[model samples]
Target chain A: MSIQIIKQGMADSIQDNGRYGYQHLGINPNGVMDPIAATAANLLVGNDLNDAVLEMHFPASVILFKQQSLIAICGADLLAMINDVFVPVNTPIIIEKNCVLHFKKPLSGARTYLAVKGGFDLQPWLGSYSTNTKAVAGGFEGRNLKKHDEIRFRAAVQKYDAVLNGKDCEILQWKASVKNFYAAGNILRITTGSEYDWLNEDAKKLLLSSSFTISNQSDRMGYRMKGDNLAIENKQQLISTAVTKGTLQLLPDGQFIILMADHQTTGGYPKIAHVISADIPTLAQLNAGEKIQFNIIGQQEAEGILFDQQQQLQQLQNACSFPLLKFKQQYAIN
Target chain B: MKSPLPYHILPLGDHALTIELGNSIDASVNQNCIAVFHQLKQAGLAFVKDIIPAYASVTVVYDVTAIRKEKPSAYLFMKEKLEILLAGMDLDQPVSHRKIEIPVCYDLSLGIDLQEMSQEKNMSIEEIIQMHTNKSYRVFMIGFLPGFAYMGSVDEKIITARRIQPRTNVAAGSVGIAGEQTGIYPLDSPGGWNIIGQTPLKLFDAKRENPVLLEAGDMVSFTAIDINEFHIIKGSI
Candidate 1:
């Protein structure tokens, strides 16, 4: 009936697409870091894209399932296992009652997502299930998942009669291809920002030519970068303005930070660039000390990539629902 | 009717676009930004998710999937729509401005930095309170925290810089001034502003029908209140 967290993770919380339309009131949209992965995980489990999912970081929480259920993990490959047996990512898996789910070690990527079949049974705050830890609203007591916290699933998954074997977990046949979304290399595509002209010619050149290391001070708020000191022509007291996720703001001390999912609604720093919306999933998977380079692409190209990604997600959602409907009709006709 | 101000549309990202009217925080520039905000919201564009108005800019967040169905590019479609909306529009038209009177208690107990600001500005606490309550301010932006409305143009004589070291936790309803701008702390947060007063009224109530008390482009004026009145009003809410 419920999944109890036996071991605590660094920062595991329930998240969905995001809480939107509240940025004007200074309320940020705190959602999943990797939308591609989160959406893929939800689609694999035949849940709505906006259904609540557990976003877990490395050293993720250990959970004990008290009922048979369907789930899928995506994003970072944290070496997930069920009862000490390895389970693949981006594939729907059926877990038997009283099974334990845990992660082995930090393999690749910074965060991962786990989606349940019918989603979590909880009241949403301000029209979203995404947890806003700063505002202390929405999702599992408005905080990170810790030890001994029990989260109830909306409905128990009907026992899969096709695979009625003595096994702790049953991995399905079909899997989703999420590799194209996370492109090769650390080169992130970006477009010029409002204050891109503030940087001198050499500083502008340095931005594209050099690779910056993601500093250890980075967090969900933003990723501070360390690289060549890019100097501006002058320091002007700019008026504070609306900023969004993926904004690359230049600090006064010459470093820059890529604002992430939990960034402030407004900022005063000069915005030098913004990572393309399509590539935010790739950027979200990067960990501290990882070196990343920026490449400025045209705005049209950025929009094209984002549009294509949405289309691909829709196609995946359509493809996954067919088999899920057939399986439900055959076994659970209630 | 006066023509609209010259502005440039810049892409914040693939999903959003920012309209920069000017560089400074002039009233006209801010008004123009607010005008665009109202017009876009009234248009009822299904693709548009949200619109934010700052000092001299307005950002429109849109869904690329929906935009792609209608037009090839979201930026190009939105920019053209905005350009057309601004062209036929008259900037001289009066915008909807709600003048709200806020009750603030300037007692030294709640006004943590009143004594320090009084000495630094070479004025008495009473004079400081009078100067703060005398003039009205415009809500240029609501940011930094939920319901945190950034009001501007504090009395020149009482203009003070932020604290050298910011306090880790400034209580909610604390009114503070930093440079030429003054704002209320809707939530207890780390801030460097010089606190001069506290309002018993909740700046933000998530359970309330309207979560935020103030919005961008509203007119705000403060009235001095005694501690007894502050407690009375605080208890009623």
Candidate 2:
């Protein structure tokens, strides 16, 4: 029920819900920025919400355990393989002990998450298992996994006779499709910033309607974007304060600064619009030069969408037919 | 455009509001930002999660779902609320702010830009030190890096621009000047600020409950200290 690193691939690291409560201390909350994909894979394997998983940047390779276990891969259409054969994403696959699981470089996007049945058991620091490479704290020695790193799992697994006995290879019905939630290069929804009045009506219209490209100067800290020039009522210095993920910092150079998962705690740029919280995951998948437009939606609508997303996740949890796992033990609550 | 002080009240995800304090750069507006920002911090709204104040504006992170349940028109409601907040902003008001006294050593060893700045300002090393420590500066805002406090207007005589080439790492608590602004480096990081002196007081501590000691609208004063006091404070921390 465990795996070890033989070849660490590119940039594989340990990630969970990210380290919170430390942002005030100048630490970035580094974690799996794509919650939907990570959580979906976790739920499929019956793991806790905050369980640590292996986050592979682009692609990676691993050696399987001595015991058989369930595993799921989610996010990014990175060409993946189990041993030498191609493996599909979003479905639970059982791998025999001592098998090699390898993933190829991203055919399209970056970041692929791999979750195991019993979850990866690594000690957390400051209440989180997420890694911050810049701060050199938490997760895999405050760094990414390297070759010859021995990884281990904590809990013993009580095997569930794979449900859907009628099903054969790749139980597509048992999983939910998160790919449907996104449309490549679509307009991201935005809400007006406090500085909108500073911009003329034409500039506001441009901000709402024009297309913006993610600039080359980007990283986990922020996405420097090139788009319509937003005119401020006046130009001057900005004092610093707490800026979080999804924060849009309008720089003096007339470019938009969209804060990301690993952004600094504070900023001086005037934010013109905030990338809606629900849309942040969408932003996470974006690469440099990918163009996107803004679609303004009401705050209530945004919240309703978030609430609905959470509700859907809860629904998946409740509808899980655990009792049906073993017909003989079906009626037993324990 | 009018007395209402036109600006935008934008949304930041489910828990933030980006509030533009004024249309442009004005010292009066910056002071207003400090004032209203302090008031809102005291008011404490449930929808609001965090408020970020910048040079000429402020951003308020809030949960919009909590703010509006009825699905009201965002354009009308947000604009109206923004106007009311700005209209009510009164300058002749008082609010409590935190005060921090920093101990500095302006010795030549740690300050890389000292000699050049001294020559430019046409003053001796001691004259520059006295001029910098003479005034109590306000923390206008915090940005760039963690614990980095952007402060202002130190006698104009010693005012200087950023270094032509940024240093790879500026020691923590190092006090510097960049283009008429004085600030303290909260963490050791690569910076372009003109190095003038170094402070022993910790600007940021991850182990502490409140990581950053300084906030917007707070007052800071530099008090020169001997190496003995510097060593004591360092050991105590």
Candidate 3:
């Protein structure tokens, strides 16, 4: 019925899809950095796409389950373990009571998502369970999960036991396909923003060809990138306007910043490009000091990729039902 | 008489569209922006998620998933619908304004940067206070942080630039002026504005139905008060 955090990991917090409609009030739509991975984890646990999940960065937490429950780990390959046994990612597993789950070492990606069956029993703020730490609102006390924090599950013990079928632990045969969601290598697909033409020819060329290193100053708000100085031809002051997640802004000093999940509602910098929604998860998984390149894609192509991804998610939702049906057939009484 | 406002509807991305009303801060332009924002919300577009109005633009964030269900292309559908709405829209419609009065204490202790600002501006403390409280300011936008309303074109005589070294944490409700803008800090955060006074009002309360006291289209006027009155208001809250 509940899980207790033995050791809080680095920047772990409960997040749903996001808190929408409040950007006008300067409220950021703080949520899971990688929505694709979060959705995949939820699907594995028989939860809705927008269900709240635990989003953890590297060097994540250790938890002890107080009751039997079904769970799924997705996103980064964090090398999670149950007691001494290794647990795999992208697959659903049933944990017995008193079992300890711990994550160790740096995996391939930066973030890991954990989804429990029936989602977390938490109140939503402004129609979302996403935590906005700056505002001190939403999620679990509006902050990152700390050691000794107890999270209660909405699922009943009897329901999870039915899925477990008297087994102490069980790993489902099926796994979520995540390879297609991420881009190959470090190239992030992007589309030209409204101010794309404001850059000089040399700066525009450098933007497309040069490789940029993610600076240590990067955070949930934005990724400060270090590369060639991209100068604008006009150097005119752009009026402050609405800036969304993935908007690539050019600072006055000619540096670049990619806005993220917790980006401000509006910004004054010139927006040169925007990372496609389909490729945001790939960008989110990249760690600081990691080198990445921008590959400009047409608007039509970006839209096509997004549509395909949504279709794949729909397929995943449909595919997950088979396992639920099998569990019911084997465990439910006639 | 005011001329008709010219606007451009540009795509922020696949999911969001921004209507650029003008490039500068003007009352008429902002009023038109607010009017259009209200109309769009009243239109009740099924795919629209969030509508954010700023100094010179109104960004409409829509749900691509919902938009795609009805049309073959999400962006095209949004663009077309928005364009149609804009074509038939009235840009001169008057928007209702809410005038809010905030009480501020300009005590020497509370105004952390008052001495520095007074020396820089070569003005007396009473003159500085008079200039700040005389004029009513317009809320251009609420940004930088939640409930932090960016308001005004402050009087030129009292206008000043941001501090070279920002304070590590400016106490919440501290009224500060930077450049032509003046705002009250809704939270204790790092800021560089020239602090002139402090208010007792809780500008932001998440528990309240409307978390932010001021929004993009409100009018704000400050009333100078003494330290004793500040304490009295603080205790009541």
Query: Runs in model 3 with CA error above 4 Å?
Result: A159-168, B1-5
Off by over 4 Å in 1: A161-164, A329-334
Per-residue lDDT tens digits of candidate 3, residues A1-334?
A: 7989999888899998899989989998989999999999999888889999999987898999998777899999989888877889999888888889888777788899999888899889999999999878898889999999999987666455665566567787888888888999889989999999999999999999999999999888899999999999877888788999999999988999999999999999999999999888998899999999989988767877888888899898789878766865777711
Better model by TM-score: candidate 2 vs candidate 3: 3
**Which lDDT values do the candidates have, in the order given?**
0.89, 0.69, 0.88
TM-score for all models, in order of appearance: 0.96, 0.77, 0.97
Candidate 2: Cα lDDT at A202: 79
The candidate that wins on TM-score is 3
lDDT of 2 by residue, A232-253 (tens): 7756555554567777788776
Cα lDDT of candidate 3 equals 0.88
lDDT of 1 at B7: 88
Docking quality category of candidate 3 according to DockQ thresholds: medium
- Quote the lDDT for A238 in model 1: 86
DockQ-based CAPRI category assigned to the predicted complex of candidate 2: acceptable
